[model samples]
Target: MYEKELEAILPRCFEMYDFMAEHVEQLQHLEAMPELKLRMAFQSGILSFEHGLSSLKLIADGFTSSGFALMRPQYESLLCGFWLMYADTEAWFNKLSTAGKVSPDEIKKLETPLIGVMLKDLEKSNAPAHILRQLNDFRGINNSAFNSFTHSGLAALVSNGVGYEPKVIYDSLRNCNAVAAINMQMLSILTGYEEAMEPVRKMHHHFVDCLPIIHG
Candidate 1:
């Protein structure tokens, strides 16, 4: 039963996975030193997207909870990476400058800014209100919901012992697609990968048409 269901979803999952890998490859070619922190964040997000793809494969193979659990960190990496890019460019660079000699500790410290702090910084920036609202929705709703799956919450428990359902698999695919699309978009913008924009835009449009509502 689950095998048949898995067979049905594999095509679409593979397609999305291919697109994500291509985007990550493009990101790899980017010169990361100028905006090192932002670029590293984008790279981390891309890596997480790859992990999500692996998890999607697991879900397709019927390891539902295991796959769903991976989504939380995957989504966090995307959002946190974008927040680092969006919040304060000057301040990020300033922090790096003040650190004097570049060390692993300094790099790790730069990446340690809390999402809450990033959001607050973003809110105070000159960015438009709609973008802020969208990010808030992502953090409050989508991220919170994804976290539930990892925490052994009702979402994780409810599907246990239930036989295979196509809806569950489809939902997982949609989520993986959405996260990958978002990560690609952020990486393109942050890395100045102009060539990545067309595919990113296409993926964004497809996601808007088919997936659950996730602002930003």
Candidate 2:
């Protein structure tokens, strides 16, 4: 794997994690909302952000394939959060609330839309246009890679088998950072404190080098 090569990038990756961690900590206390939908939306975004940070740790330690496997969940959580905000009428949230006390099998029976359905639903729900555009672009570019990583396809086999370059690790880290930024921004929105997001914007621009947008 990239055991030796990882050293060259670990410091920057760690810094990115710390920067995001700070934002997460700040957002957590600020997202106090009694509204059920907003609370759930904030929680989902936090989950996505956690996945990004966890993936960074795994990738930094040379577990690139495992790290990548986390990306799809990260993406899905963020998507679901938005879908909750716009597409849902508290139905799914209610189902989830009750499912918490139900058996695992019963919980599995909960009606949740697949990714395609969610996307279509979101479009009609007036989901943020900027987010929709970014999501479409991100998925169009990375759908296959996301599947490969999560499903242990050829891409995962290759990364785990022969290993990859340090730059690949850097790119992966940056990609995770991109999702983290999006999640943090979404959390900021939930906070209803425009000033809370000022730091988020600053953090994003300050570390924009790690975002995929920089590459494009």
Give the distance in Å from residue 41's predicted Cα in candidate 2 to where it truly belongs.
Answer: 1.1
Best by lDDT: 2
Cα lDDT tens digits for candidate 2, 26-101 = 8788764668878988999988988888887787676889998998899889987888788955666777778768
TM-score of each candidate structure, all chains considered together: 0.72, 0.85
Off by over 4 Å in 1: 1-9, 89-117, 126-135, 143-145, 163-165, 204-216
Q: Candidate 1 lDDT, tens digit per residue, 1-216? A: 455644665776677678667767876787443666676677777767777787777776768778878876776676677666666767667776767677776677655466677678778776447646655665665565466667988756776656447765665566566667666767777666577688777765644533456544
Q: List the residue pairs that clash in candidate 2.
A: none
- lDDT: worst 10-residue window of model 1: 207-216
TM-score of 1: 0.72
lDDT of each: 0.67, 0.78
Error (Å) of candidate 2 at residue 63 is: 0.7
State in Å the error of residue 140, model 2.
Answer: 1.9
Off by over 4 Å in 2: 1-10, 94-104, 214-216
lDDT of 2: 0.78
